[model samples]
Target: MVFCIRRAYRSEQAGFRAGKFLTNPTKAGRGHVNNLRYRSSTRKKVSLLLMLRSSARILLLSQAASSSFITSSSPVSRLQSAQFRTSARTMSEMTPVFTKDACPPAGPYSQAIKANGQIFVSGQIPADVNGNLIEGNIGQKTEQCCKNIAAVLEAAGSSIQKTVKVNIFLTNMADFAEMNETYAKWFAHKPARSCVAVAQLPKGVPVEIEAIALQ
Candidate 1:
């Protein structure tokens, strides 16, 4: 009896290792073990297929997110695009105005700049075309400054009559009456104007003038 029990125990161990079991040790029992093995193999294959499908879904989602990031219309990006367009348009429209009929600029700046349907004249002191300070009283000095502005406007395809704004700088308010007298002769259309007194002006002149005129 001991020998027969040991033999049966060894047979059971060998069956387990081979993916089979001997419950009844008959033909029907062997067929049931084969059915169990088939079910286990089917489950493993189904599990592998599910895992592959899940990985593919994850990869597709990642690719879609990357594509969305490339075409993102965030606020900062939109603002940057707008600013670049504005800068490019402004640069293309801007053009410098120069003429020997006007006083030469005393510094590293254009005598006038034309852009956006307007001409912007730089501050003009009482100077001649050669950049020499003119010899005159306050009224004459103001007239000379207006003449320089007119020349710049003409060069830029604008005119003093089309001036939309004028900015006047004076070293003394006492000369306002004289300056206004000469200014009215030039800007008779009564464009927008602002006059202010400063400590001094360029080239030691008592007055400086600048203007903006429509093209």
Candidate 2:
């Protein structure tokens, strides 16, 4: 059997000769057992080293990819965070403007509200602090409205000169010329404006004006 032949190869006195054991063994036969063990061990060590190198390369690549991904996304994340903070500040910064110098509100609204570096003045009619209507000509009524708007702006940490936009409502279009002349005097900077005729105004005032301005 092949097993019996291989067993004989390990014996000191055996040599390959057909199926018989020779009396004198060759040099290959003498050292075959130890040489086979050394070669097998060396192959195992080489295989182990190759597997370790492959694993190390995979680990390094994974770490490098993760670092690159983080680097690419960092700026976008910071930008989004900054935008969110700005939006929050804008939402939370609204403050009501109130001063005894301005005509009081006729209803439930504030005279003005300041937010995000701007002031929003509500429509002002010809009225005093007690909401009493002022009977006046078209030009005088327009002047009173502008004065109320100015007072509101000052309360909101801004000034009439800072006005950026204006809206005026009139009960009659015939008074447009008078209103415009009075308006030109108050808003020397000539802020953008729109004027329209309305059916009625609060307190029967002939003119009502609202303004928006920088704070």
Candidate 3:
């Protein structure tokens, strides 16, 4: 009976050891499963954070591109034109009109006419208002003609400084130097001009000048 009891006790010890071994394996497997689940959860979170950051960056870039397009396509904001009738009338109101009576023509023509910011002066000879021809050399004739043109330009609300174009007719081409010397004194700005020598002039004048001046 002592032998049998020892054997039974050994058997019981063996069974307990077997059960502990099985339990330890199951616990270890459960811990491995839990670790795998935690690892998966961490990976998913990292992926979601990366995706969110990428989405935010894309959205910011899109918004920036849209803002740039809007600014580039926008039109200018300043007023293109002003109300001329209400703003100012100096250009229109101050324009002068010279009639036949104001400056009697030396020949058969009007003195000057103002239209559209320009003064058109007829060809003026070396003659006074009373239709008397001026005498002397080419210098004297050029001075008289320039003075007549000045008067007509002034009557038309213009001046020698504003003269844009001029045409001079001289009976003698040799007198060009003398005429130009006197003409330079009247128009310091030196307007665009075309000088031609003609065989004859009205009233046998030495020089005649026509000018177009800006108001």
Candidate 4:
């Protein structure tokens, strides 16, 4: 009886050891599969995060490039548009002014004519406001003539400094020195001038002066 009991106990111990060995391998395999699945999921999540970060960086760079392009293009477009308009306006404003009541011609000539943005005033004798001659010596007559020219120039929207050219007609060559002294005082800009003694002048005036002034 004692031997049989010992044999039974030994047999049960052996069976328990065999069952433990077989079940341990299946449990280990299941645990390894679960670990592999977890690792794969973590790797996929990390890859998605990296792709998102790259896409975000590219989007930011694209926006920055677009902003830079707009910033550079605006000033160039404004300059080109301004240049075109200025050129057109400059061309259009170059036309001359001519009117019927521009003070009747003193001697078969226009009193003040405009061309090329300049006023060409005819030689003004010592003439009254009514275009009639005022008779006097060189000094007195020159003052009156200058006054007349001033009136015409004012009417034409110009002034003495703007005078580009001047022509002084003298009856007597002896008065040239005195006339020049007085003319110099009036015209400080010193426009291009030509003084000549003519055979005769209208209304027998001693001096007649004409000027061309810019607008």
Candidate 5:
């Protein structure tokens, strides 16, 4: 059972060759078509095995042009349907951290930056909410730095116990012992750390400390 398009069977009549209409004795309108197809009113599939008494190529063309069916053997046609699909793994987004309870940043930066399930607290000094350097000994100033870092981490949804790394800047190497004593009490977990003696710190403070903590 099959469908058929009744183009004057090109193979039956050798005289009816491919594109024979192009050699018409007399030309017609610009959009004139060689409408050589017909169909049966009934929806039943008709096997035109009798009508297709010709070459395989002619039968192939007839089946394609027929209105009742579709063929999908051409590579060019199938290639047009090919698509490039790539699944891209997306991760959670990051954001900045801020807290009015902590000393405001003295420069053009946020107190912390939260990213990839972690929070990075910026370097903090012994300054009050008013941005004034707290007048005290090295131990007191170190405590203040820890306090500020704690506040910033709390606002960023983290804490000192979760701190993974710490970087400290000291104006005087002799103050390292005093800063460590204060820093130790704040971080009982003893997170990784590095301290260096710089020529000076922000606002001429004795110490500055920054930290990275897990969320």
Candidate 6:
């Protein structure tokens, strides 16, 4: 558009200079010469306005095309699309872990969910595979909880050795020592752990344990 405008301006100036030479001042009166100059000035003004309008239209079309390209091909737009696809794939790849070897889930939840090369085991109380609560002290209860976690990990193709984090909930803080005694024997790798005294546990159990492990 700019090139077109420059060309038109240059041609108009050249025509104006040529008109001076083309018209013979000696063959006409002063009034006749002024009238001819007025007509020439009017023609050039009209031509310039037409050229400017054409340039404006061309500029608008070029801007519209550029905006359309940016909307469809910008980096931010492409990145957002890729992230959405990755999230959907991760959600679809998640696999629920369940086994007859471990105690059944007491509520409407999976025993464990395996996703992104990790196992997320739900909290396990001191119960057998039949969902029967085990009768024993805190140490025995802790042992049963660890056993159930081991079973769930095995079902998900993971193991106690790979356990990365453990959470232990107890109804009484005094039971911490006994629970640690049994817990240390199971988690020899000494993964990160948190033990908190809660007001109560499901089925009135003294302790419950949950774990996370890398597959």
Which one wins on lDDT?
Answer: 6
TM-score for all models, in order of appearance: 0.66, 0.64, 0.53, 0.51, 0.58, 0.72
- lDDT of the candidates, in the order given: 0.84, 0.80, 0.73, 0.72, 0.75, 0.88
**Candidate 2: tens digits of C-alpha lDDT, residues 1-215:** 33443343343222222113322223377455555554566456556555665676787799889888876678887788889999999989988899888788878999998888899999999887777777779998888888889888887778999999999999999999988999999999999999999999886778899999998
Clashes of each: 0, 0, 0, 0, 0, 0
- Per-residue lDDT tens digits for candidate 6, residues 1-215, read 66666667677666766665666655669756874875579587758767796878888888998898777888988899899998899899999999999999999999999998899999999999999998988899899999999999998998999999999999999988888999999999999999898998999999999999999
Q: Which 10 successive residues of model 3 have the least lDDT summed?
A: 74-83
**lDDT tens digits, residues 93-160, model 1?**
99999999989999999999988788899999999999999997999999999999999998888889
Residue ranges of candidate 1 with Cα displaced over 4 Å: 1-80
* Candidate 5 local lDDT, 1-215, one digit each (tens): 22334333323333334335444534564323342221221111223434443445576677667633334545654555452111111133558898987889898999999876789899999988778888889999999999999999988878888999999999999998988899999999999999898998778788999999999
lDDT of 5: 0.75
Tell me how far the alpha carbon of residue 108 in candidate 5 is from the true structure, in angstroms, after superposition: 0.8
RMSD of 4: 22.3
Locate the minimum summed-lDDT window of 10 residues in model 5.
Answer: 37-46
Model 4 lowest lDDT segment of ten:
95-104
After aligning candidate 2 to the native by TM-score, how far in Å is the CA of 184 from where it should be? 0.9
Per residue, candidate 4 scores C-alpha lDDT tens digits across 82-154 of: 8989877766665443334333465556777766577888887877766676666677777777777777777
Listed per candidate, the RMSD to the true structure in angstroms reads: 12.1, 12.5, 21.7, 22.3, 13.3, 6.4
Task: Write model 3 residue lDDT over 19-71, tens digit each, in one string.
Answer: 44444434557765765555566556556555665676787799889888766
Off by over 4 Å in 6: 1-73
**Model 2 steric clash pairs:** none
Name the lDDT of candidate 6: 0.88
